[model samples]
Target: MKAETDFDKAEKLYNQKKYSEAKVLFESFLKENPNNYKSIEYLGDIAGHQKDWNEAIKEYKILKNQFPKTANYWYKYGGALGMKAKSVNKFKALGMIDEIESSFLMASKLDLKHIDSRWALVMLYIELPGIVGGSESKAIKYSNELMNLSKVDGYLSKGFIDEYFKRFTKAEMNYKAAHEIGNSKITFQKLYNLYLNKIKDKFKAQKLKEQFEK
Candidate 1:
């Protein structure tokens, strides 16, 4: 039997979100055909999306080496670094600020059309520490950018948004947003009720009750 085509295998793995496996296939294909920038870029994206930050960083690093004139590679690399720092090593988090911002800045400068890169930069800006990379204004700015990118009213995203903004009242307005969307497979109602009962304040309880009714 003939081996599966590189594209076919990669596509299947990608659809499954099997970044590590997909990346291996992509890398093998790239080794045979180094000019496939799109494949390389997608590999980096998949790695990042899968939260395999180191793999993402490695993929982007390869792209940056191949396409030194473009900033997208660097931007992706920095974003991966930022995620790695944030989710894994708090001590290394601040150190990545310069790398993250620089990549975003370069990507913006190189291609004003790369909304995703810019949006990534914005998110990093929002998540960074105040002494390091945190800025409330920047957070709001990037949050808006992310919302615009998402055409659908994403239930999980909206819930996090409400939680972040302290708009718990509004969260109840769409608590069903997640529940219905997930077909009740994801139970926020149970989690919310748990929190509601844990609170000691009467006014807070009343507020929760009113919000739950909505």
Candidate 2:
């Protein structure tokens, strides 16, 4: 009961964004309750939020080993690895790509309805260069998969890819479609940026921005 009480306090601190304080409490709690999955998960999340990717990776790796079948654990592990790759040399980043991809893939396979894993794959495929495992086809494939699961996310992913390629018209179209489907603030923001930056239509951009603000 005392351990649970302490953990709840630590979690409240984490929720309040007192990450450093929360980390100390969580660490102490884990020392007493080594197999507490929730504490371990929060420790990993705290490390990631603090941009301590190595520590995040280490914590998530423990979670992955402890909960091999849990999709969320693998997804988080992949996400941490992806963030770590962004901060490293190109060669090192390249080496991490396979592990990152494998983790996301495992998560997706474990839970077909895991939208976060699919979204991560879409971004990964779009951001990496072809020489190092990125593929436009793979991006489109995941986008299609997301579409099958959630029309709004699918269109948003497609818009993101088109925007990346500077295909402003296609991006605008997809963003509009996503907006029609979900009216999400994110879709409006993307449309606002597209009109302001790529289409150079301040009027449309202002309207989109206003919609986003609402």
Q: How well is each residue in 1-214 modelled by candidate 1, as lDDT tens digits?
A: 9888786798798888787788788888988988888787888798778788898898888888888768768777777877787786667666767887887778866875666675665566555667876665765554455446542234444444455556665655455455544434243443354346432345755654566567
Q: List lDDT for all candidates, in order.
A: 0.66, 0.93
Residues 95-199 of candidate 2 have per-residue lDDT tens digits of 999999999999999999999999999999999999888999999998999999999999999999999999999999999999888877777777887899899
TM-score of 1: 0.58
lDDT of 2 at 177: 96
Best by the TM-score measure: 2
Q: Report the number of the highest-lDDT candidate.
A: 2
Cα misplacement distance, residue 156 of candidate 1 (Å): 12
* Candidate 2: residue 90 Cα off by (Å): 0.7
After aligning candidate 2 to the native by TM-score, how far in Å is the CA of 130 from where it should be? 0.8
